[model samples]
Target: MNYKLIVVMLFLVMGALVEGKRLANLGHKLKQEAEKVGKEAGHILEGKVAQKAADVVFNAVLRKG
Candidate 1:
């Protein structure tokens, strides 16, 4: 009976370890995806800002002439 209990405990511990590792991997994947999305958004925003600045400069030059 004692041996059986020990075996059961060991299995439970092993299972918990496997589950923890799986969760860690999932968290890492989610973090990487979030970073990728952030970078893409930043690039799009930068382009829009640059275009707006160019337009403003162009209009100013035209008005002066």
Candidate 2:
């Protein structure tokens, strides 16, 4: 019934919606990246180099993305 409480509740709801969308997009991107990495990793390299590349790429993507 109070004006201040109504405004605060509306702000909280709007924030939750925005944050939920960003989180959803991030989750979707991670899934797609994981699959892409898995497929690409299976090709065209030896043991240590392949392993190192995968580690480096995965870490970089996870960090930057």
TM-score of each: 0.88, 0.61
Tens digit of per-residue lDDT, candidate 2, span 1-65: 99999999999999999999999999999999999888777663566687999999999999999
lDDT for each residue of candidate 1 in 1-65, tens digit (9 for 90 to 100): 69999999999999999999999999999999999999999999999999999999999999999
Candidate 1, residue 32: lDDT: 100
- TM-score of candidate 1 relative to the true fold: 0.88
Worst 10 residues of 2 by lDDT: 39-48
Best by TM-score: 1
